[model samples]
Target: MQVQKTTIPHWSEDDRPREKMMLKGRNSLSDAELIAILIGTGSGMKSAVDLGREVLLLTNGDLYEFGKLRLSQLCEIKGIGKSKAVSILAALELGRRRKEIQTEKRPKIDSSEKAFKELRGYFTDLSHEEFFVMYLNRANELIQVKQLSIGGISGTYVDPKIVFKYGIDVGACGIILAHNHPSGNLKPSESDEKITKRILQFGDLIEMPVLDHLIVTDNGYFSFSDQELL
Candidate 1:
């Protein structure tokens, strides 16, 4: 009988992801290279690069889309079990926070256009629905932007009571409501109008006032207040 030889994985080399990153100066790397730096290693049949490629494909080229996926969804990829999925998500979130910290230097919101432009980078690529409350001072200076809820496109279930809590907590004198249409239309649905009416009604009671309700699509937005609807 002939003896069979087993092949060793190059990814097992001590200086793989880190060494490649240092040698290439980061910008020269592919998506798989950057992701492999975060993911560390792979299993028998798949290399770390292969696992990262699958992740990108599964997410349709948007890394933020991975945040919308369930752990079960990620585990369906051959080499990415729950732990690896968590690790990737955690690293991505950290990157988001770091980027946000750097964004603090950008000009703050003064007009509805400024507000939408500020929010577009975050909401543009979301796979699921999300609602945001952009708190503003009396002069329309940006105070804080809150993530009110993450739910289905039909609704995000904004409560007048909880919305008020965030307003009071942030000491906002006024607020602008904004949510994205994944369908890429700026038209406000019945649910969007309903939620806007309810929030405005509560703002009436609190004296904080609703500045606007902005329905954002990928390409543009409709402003309820600007249109004299709010």
Candidate 2:
């Protein structure tokens, strides 16, 4: 006869993490209990909750630090294999993306600093050049943000037509252009100035103004409009 496997169901329903989450709601669960549900199971002599507590201790009880852990680092915990580590990482990434999207949804861009604060998160971690554009309606409320190109550390080529196409597609009346400087330099290159002027001219013709051009770096940002170049 096969021996019956022991699992979380063997515990009282109140003590079972998944059941507690369903009945009492997710916010009712403790951090370890939530992690235990993600891990799903534990090694011999350790319950999932016990294993989760160990993992929390390893990260000094910080969820942000826990999210930064690599797969190899997580696997050092006895019950956390590649699959569990990947699941945790994927969940954390989704949470981060959702937060970014929510921040972009309805904010009006009234100043260079406000635009930088809203858009910097997208470029802060990048190691190469990336061109992004924020489409805005007449009220200066953001409609959407789009990545136009990815290139080497030196620069990226952005097609003005594609930028305008996205603006037209979204019914945008204005736009803000942004690009990152991997070397942490805030000064715009000659190519940057040239493109800004070209795009500004096009926007004027179409009655859709280029509100600003921002050079983002990990340290800070430079705005063309603030410098009186726009």
Candidate 3:
């Protein structure tokens, strides 16, 4: 059987991808339009937009996750040959590099909320236990937020040493330890008590105060310090 050709129209002032981009702005473009701008054209049967849609759906709407796929996997798309696959991958890498460069000039950790905002988006649907350490400066401004452990909803392991080492290494004057229960219970548990006591003791030795131990859930929060445990 012979393959039939599908033709794209000649570039025109009103319809050209670059002109449309300049007139409407990048943000105004649909996902397919944005991808078509990158890919330039379609193959025998499909438009670049249709090809890009297939790629996105295969990766569950995350382009970064799609980039993790092998080049052979990308080339499996009917219209995406090895060169086109490489172009897509190169575009992804350029985006990744640009983001890294923009964020690397200075690392800012302003507050516990700001430091942990990344976690909020990612953890909204988690079904297991998770823990985080928030390192703070003398003024209680955040320096870093680290995930120390993740376990089943009722169980987790967190090393006081690992948590404190970051504090000591960063010369943090204080720390706010926090974690979430997927069950939405902000109340501290026996294990939570044990870990808090151990971490507080470690902090005391180095003169780095553990300002507050907070158990925050999607529903609300509970503070051991607020309860006079600190």
Candidate 4:
């Protein structure tokens, strides 16, 4: 039998991902550089880096929402074949798994960041307004998350009575309110503030405190509690 040698992977003439990772360290590599390493090569006039940048641009550079992408959606990108798409998705899946392993059994909402993480999934990528309420126990451990209403791109109606009903039904001690701004603006509109006060007032009357109100956008979240608006 003839001897055979193993193959290796690199990115471009300089193999920037590999070289930069080796010289500086893996942490020094940008998201594009890391993605290029997995994709392996260029297509047409685009380099691996260019392809990586395109993918990031599609997601607006947030890796947390990367899991929402489907194989078909990824393949729609120019020059990204099924193989390359799978490669990217597989890597993302692994990252999700690792995070899941490290995640707490019952996610405790001790801070705005945790609250945002708990509810962002529901609102991300929504093209219209949708209201969600997360019921939490006394210790702030999530009891349940629910969608209360859906509205057009403009706004959603959040009935404080209906919200109180959900919390009462779940025997929740506190509640977190969230709604998406499909326009990618995190600022709380006048309507947003008014609703928060209404819900907060009713929540106090019922003894189910409103801990936080989050306005989710494509880029990030605006937290009422964090801003002392709650």
Q: Candidate 2's residue-wise lDDT over 1-230, tens digit each?
A: 97665667699999999999899999999998988888888777778888889888878998756755677888888878899888777877776676467452589999999899888867744668999999999999988889999999899999899999999999999999999998988999999999999999999989999999999987889999999999
Native RMSD of candidate 4 (Å): 7.2
Per-residue lDDT over 151-216 for candidate 1, one digit per residue giving the tens place of the 0 to 100 score: 876556778788889889888898888888887777888888888999899899889999888888
Say which candidate scores most in lDDT.
2
Query: What TM-score goes with each of the models?
Result: 0.75, 0.68, 0.56, 0.59
Per TM-score, the best of the predicted structures is 1
Give model 2's TM-score versus the native structure.
0.68
Residue 201 lDDT (model 2)? 93
| Model 1 stretches astray by more than 4 angstroms | 1-15, 59-70, 99-107, 121-128, 183-185, 201-206
Candidate 2 has its poorest 10 consecutive residues by lDDT at 96-105
Using lDDT as the measure, what is the rank order of every candidate, best first? 2, 4, 1, 3
Residue 11 in model 4: lDDT? 39
- Model 4 ranges with Cα > 4 A deviation: 1-104
Which pairs, if any, clash in model 3?
none
lDDT of 3 by residue, 160-179 (tens): 88988888888788888888
- Which residue window of length 10 is worst by lDDT in model 4? 4-13
Report the C-alpha lDDT of model 4 over 53-148, residue by residue, as the tens digit: 888887898876666688898888898999999999898767655543324567888888998887766765467999999899998998888889
TM-score of 4: 0.59
Superposition error at 70 for model 1 (Å): 4.1
* Native-referenced Cα lDDT, model 4: 0.83
